[model samples]
Target: MKRFFLLVLCIFATSCTGGGSCAGKKEVAALPDTFIWNLYSDPKSIDPGLVQENSGSDVGVQLFEGLTEYHPETNEPVPALATSSDVSSDGLLYTFHLRQDAKWSNGDPVTAHDFEYSWKRALDPKTGSYYASYFYIIKGGQEFNEGKNTDGNSVMVKALDDVTLQVTLKHPAHYFPQMIAYPAYRPVHRKTVETFGDKWTHPEHIVSNGPYKLVSWEVQKEMVAEKNPYYWDAQNVRINRIRFLLIEERETALKKHLEGSAHYTDDIPTLKIPTLKSNPHYHDAIQLATYYYSINTKKKPFDDVRVRQALAMSIEREKITNVLQQGYPTRNLVPPGIPGYTTAKGLSFNPEKARQLLSEAGFQDPKTLKVTLSYNTNENHKLIAEMVQNMWKENLGVEAELYNQEWKSHLKNVEEGNYEVGRFTWIGDYVDPLTFLEITTTASTQNYSKWSNPVYDDLVLVQSGKERDPKKRFELLQQAEEMMLEQAPLIPLYHYGRPLLLDPRVKGFYGNLQDMHPVKFAWFEEEK
Candidate 1:
C-alpha cells in the first residue's frame, strides 16, 4: 500500500509540478515479508459454505482453493486447482481437469471429489447457505437448494474421476467461470469438517488448500495467516504472512497506516482523501460496487412506488459524493460503463418533483410520516445517513430517525425486514452486469428489498434463460433494470471507489473491478 501510494504521488507530482503538492515526499521503506491489512468489520463467518460477506471472502480466498481464480492483474478467470477445461458445443457442459499435485494443508490429496462435495454441500437445503443461489445456473441447482429434490445426484455437478470434474449448466453463461472463483464454491476438507462439526473452520481445525493457513485469530482484534509451506506452488508466493485487523473507524485505520504498522485499508476518512489524494500512499479504485439503501417494499409507505421514488429523489447524491470526494455521481443500480450493457438511470433529484410525489403518495406534508434510516456503525455511514435525514426533512418534510447498529446486526435486521429502510451496498462478485441485476430478482436470497414484480422477475429469471445471443441477453437484462429503476425498491446513490491507504513497497497486488486481490501475489519490493 505504501509503495502504491508513493507511485501515485510521483505520477500526480509530475502532472502538478506547478502546484508541487507532492514535491517533498520521502522515500518509502521496504516492508518485511508480512502484509498488514484492515477490515471495516470483523468477518461474520469464515466457513467456506456459509460466509456471505466480503471481509470473510478476503480471508476465505487465502485459506481455500477453488477450481479457478481471477488473474491478479487482468481479472480474467484462470485455472487454479483445475489445470484445464473443455466445454461442450452448447456451452452448457464444463469438464474440468484438476491438477494432480494439489493437496490440503493436512497433506491429504485435493481431488475432483472435493469440489463435487463442496458444490453439492453448498446446494443442500440443510446447509442454509444464502449464497447457494450463485450456483443456480447449474442444472437442478435451484431445485436441490429449494428442496424440490432430496437427491444430490440430480444436480449436474459430478466428479468423473479423482482428477476430473464435470458440470452441466441450465444455460450457457459466459461469466460462470469467473463466478466459480467465489469462496462459496471452494472445496472444504470433509474429514476435518466431519470431525469438528460446525467448528470445522476454527483456526486449529481448519485444513486449507490455498497459499496461506490460519495461524492465529484474536477475534475482534485481528486474525493472522502465514504462508503454507506445503502449498503446491509455494515458491511463487512472496509475502510470508498477512494480518487482517478489524477496525471500523477509517480514522483509526489511517492512523495505523501512517504509523507504518498497517499496509492497507479498505477506506480512509473521507476528509483525508484530499490531503492524501496527491500522496503516493493513497489509492482509490472505482470498484464494481453500488452504494444504496434497501427500501423494504413489504413495509408501509415504502410499499408505495411514489413514496420510494420521492424518498430517493429528495436526497442530493452529488452532495454525498462531494463530501466523500470519491466515486462517480450515479443514479444507477448497475454502475455506468460496465463493459457491454447500457446503463439504466434512476429517478434524478428535483426537490419540487419529490414534494409532488410525496403528496401523491398521500403524505401531503411528509413530516407526519416517521421513518427510521438504519446503517452499520461506521462514521462514514453515519454522516451519509445524517445528510439524507436532513434532506428528507428539508426537501420533503419527512421525519427520518437515524439508527446505527453493528455490521452483523444491521445485515440481520435488513434480512428480517426489521427496518423500513436500511443502508446497504452490493459489490459485484464478477464483472457481469447480471451480477448487479440478478440480486434483486424475486427469488434471490440477497434481495433484502423484498420488492417483487412479475415483469421484472421474468426479465431476469425467465427471459434471461431463453436468450442465447450475448447482445440479446444483455437486452433482456436492461429491460429488467429499467423495470427495477421504475419501481424504485432502493435508492441509487453512487458507485464505489476503494479509497485505500497503500504501502509503497507492496507490489504485485492488483485491484480488479470487483476489488479483490489475493494476498499470495503480494510482495514487498526491495527499496532502493
Candidate 2:
C-alpha cells in the first residue's frame, strides 16, 4: 500500500540505428549488486504520527515497531515488541509485558516508558498528529487531543515499571489488537525525538527498534536500510540490507528493469501489460484499496446532496472499469471480504436520473454546471479522469474541468481544502470495514469531504464500543453504509488490482490488503 503520485516527464529520446547486418538497441543502466526496489514517490516523513497514507506507513514499518504486529498470512494480530498481554474482566484495561531483550537501534533498552511517551505524544494537541483517531479508545485521549486536558498525566496510558505497561480505555474493542499493528501505534524514542526536534525524520537523527536500521538517505535518489544487528530477532533476519530506490520516472524504471537494474517494479504501464503477461517473470497481485473522487461538502454546489447524488449517478462506472481500467474497477466503497461488507446493492449509471436530479437542483442548462475534478499525475489516473470527464459531459450535459497535480501536491490539496473534487484511494489499515468507512465521519481528520451526519456518526461510535455479537454490530454498520451510499458522499469508482513482478528466485512473498511488501522472511532459492 504505497501512496505514490503520478509524475509525467519528457520521454528519453530512443532511436533504432541499423548497421549492414544488425540493429542497435537502446542502452540502459546496469543493475547494482544490492537488492533494489523502485518507488514512485519519496515519503514526506517517516514519522508515524505525520504519515496519512500507506506508502509512508509501509516504510515506517521497517524503522518502527509497536507492541503487536499482523501476520500477513492469517491477517491476525501477533506479538512484535510486546511478549504478552492480558485484558481485565471489565475489558477496559489492558496490561502488556514488554520483550526483555528488545533494544533500540541506538542500543537503548526498550521499556514501557517508551510506549507511554509515544502514545501521549500522539494524543498531545501540540503534536498535530492526523492519525490520533486510533487512540480515541483510550480514556482521556479525546479530551487530551481536544486540549481540554493539560498533559498526558490525565490519559490512561502509563508505565507500571520498566517492562510492564498498563492502559485504560473508554470501552472494549475486539479489533483493538488489529489497530496497533499499524505504525501510528508504534513506540518512538522520546530522547531522539526531543533531540532532533524538527529534523527528527532525517536518516541521521532517527533511531529504530525494528528488524532494520536506516543506513543512508539520498532524497529523490535512493534510501538504504541495513540489518539491525541489535534487533532481538536478528538471528532470524537473513537479508544484510535492502535498497529502496526512488524511481519517479516510470519509463526509466521499466527500462532499468529490462536491463536487470532492479529486483521489483510496481504498477506496470497499461500499454505494456498485455505483452508481459506471457513472460515467465510476470506476476499479478490484487490491491485492497478503492479509488474514487470526493466532492468537498464544505464548498458550494457540493454542499447540496442532490448535486452529489446527481454527480455520482451520471458516471458510467462499467465503462470506466472496463475501458479505462480494463475491467478492474469496483463500484462499492468497502472492498469485498472485509467485515461489514455486504453485497446488498449500489447506485448504477442512469443518465436520465442524473439529468432529472440536476434539473431538480436547478442546473437545467448543463453547459452552466461546471466543477473541477482533481486527479494525480499518473498515466492510469489521467486515463480514469479523462473517462469520467467524458461521462459527466455526455450524461449530465455538464462540462467538468480536469485538474491534475503531482501525487504529493494532490494529497496536500485534499487535506488542506484546496481542491473542490479530489481523486483518492484508501487501502485498509486493517481487515475491518470500519477502517474504510469510519474515516469519512464528521470528526475524523481524514474526512476531507466535510461530510457530517449525527445519525451516521452515532451508529459508528456505538459500533466501535460494542464488543459482543458480531452480527448485530455488522447490522448497524450496514445501515451506516447505506446512508453514506444513498447520500453519495463520494462516488465509489473501482477496486484496485495491479500486476506485480515476482522474481522466480524469491519465495514467501505475498500481497497484503495494506499492500505491504514484507521482505523479512522472503528469500531466494537455488534449484537442486
Candidate 3:
C-alpha cells in the first residue's frame, strides 16, 4: 500500500516534466492575481435547472440563486433569492415571497414566473430531467413526469403574482426546505435557456443571478467567472474573479500550486499529507464524501446474496483504510457527522462469519464464482479495487477480474447497469443522512444496485408522507438503514477526507463536511 501511494506521487512528479506542455514553467509560491481551483471535468451547464451532480452544482452555486440557502456554518435554511416563505398546516402547500432586488445577470428582474417556468420545465417529460423526481412531493409532479398529466393543469407549481409563488405537494416532507437549497432546484430564466438551446452554458449564452457571472470558458483548459456587478449582493462579493482550471493530474495541480498558478487544489497526494498537515496554509480533513461499490443486483453472481456477502467479507476495510485511505473508514453508506448516523450497529468485518455465510449459501470453489469489479481511473479507486480483487482471490477462492473505465464512461456504465459490480460514491447534497442512505431505495433513480425491499420502501414512503415529528422520522430512517445493512447490496468502503493545498495569502476559501464551497467570503492578499 505504501508502495502504491509512492507510485502515485512518482507518476504525478513524472507527468510534470515531459508529459504535459506546462512542464517547462518555473514553480512559485502563489497564483498571480487570479484565484483558481482544480476540477476533473468542465461544468456541464451553468443553468441550475439542468445540473444533476456536484460538478455542475458547485459551479451553479456560484452562477445561480435559489429561493432559500443554507447558513454556511449551521446548515440552517435561510432566505436567499426569496425574502420570506410559508408552509400550510397540512405541509402540502408552500408559498415563497421573492426578494425585490433579485435580478438576472442581463439585468432582468428574476420573478416568481422564473421559478414557475423552471419547475415546469424540469417536471415536463420532454425535458428528460433526472432531478425531476426531487419535485415529486409537489402536486401532479410525478404524473407530469410520467406523461400521465399535462403541464397546463398541473398544480405542483404556479406563480400567484409577479413576486409570490405557490407550490402544492402530494405529500409533506420535512427536508423540503433543505432540498430547495440545492442547485438542481434553483430558479432559471426560461427565455435564456430557450434562446441558447444546447449552447446555454457555452460562455456567450451564460446568464447568472448569483454573485458571479461566466466571463470565459476554455474547454479542458480554464473556466473564468468574474463578479456580477449587477448582482443584488455584488458589493459584498469579496472575490473579484474566480478561475476553475481543469487539471486532471494531481502532480500538475501541485506543480501549478507550487508555481503560483493556482491558489487552491483538491487532490493532495497521500504521501504529502503529513507535510500538508504541518503547514499552516494547508487544511486537510475528511470531507463528507463516501466511497462504495454497488453490486448490480440485476446481474448474475451478485444476484446471489451469499456472493455479495462473501465479496463484502473477503476484503479488510480497516486494512484499506489504514493503507490506502488518508481519511476514515466507513461502516455503511450513511457517512458519519451527518445528522442521523449511528455507529453502534454498523457493518462488522468478520471474515469467519462471512465465510460461513458464503459456504452455507453454497459458494466453495474458486472456479464456481467469477465476477468483475469496475472502477474509474482515480488512483484511490484503482488502488482499493486492486486490494479487493487480491483479497477475494486469496480468501474466497474466487476468480475476479478488474475493469477500469474513464470517470464519465464509468458513471454511464453504473447508471445504465452495464456492470456486475461497480464503484460509486456520494457526497451529501444537503446535511441529511437520508440523502446518502436513501439513494438505495427502490424509487431512487440513483439506486444503481437495483435493490428493492418492500419493507424498506414502505418505511421511507411512510416517513416522507406522514412522519412530521423529526425524532420519529429519523427513527424510521434508522430502520431503513438497518435493512440496507442486512441486505449488503453494496460494500461500504471508507469515507473520504478532502485534502486541499492552499496558499497562505488566501482567506475565506474553505469547505465543510458537506463539501460546500463558499467562495463568496473569500479574498486574496499579496503573498509576503
Kindly list the per-residue Cα lDDT of model 2 for residues 185-270, writing each as its tens digit: 88888898999997887888888888888878888888888778888888866666767777777877776665555656776777
Best of the candidates, lDDT:
1
**Candidate 3 local accuracy as lDDT?**
0.72
lDDT of 2 at 340: 52
lDDT of 1 at 377: 87
Give me the runs in candidate 2 sitting further than 4 Å from their true place. Answer: 1-34, 324-328, 339-344
Tell me the TM-score of each prediction against the true structure.
0.93, 0.90, 0.89
lDDT of 3 by residue, 305-386 (tens): 8778877877778788787537677667777675554632555777777777777777755558788889977777778888
Best-fitting candidate, scored by TM-score: 1
Name the runs in model 1 displaced over 4 angstroms: 1-31
TM-score of 2: 0.90
Candidate 1 lDDT tens digits, 453-511: 88888888778876888788888888888879888898878898887766666676755
**What lDDT does the true structure give each of the candidates?**
0.82, 0.74, 0.72
The Cα RMSD in angstroms, rounded to one decimal, for candidate 2 relative to the true structure is 8.0
Arrange candidates by lDDT, highest first: which order?
Answer: 1, 2, 3
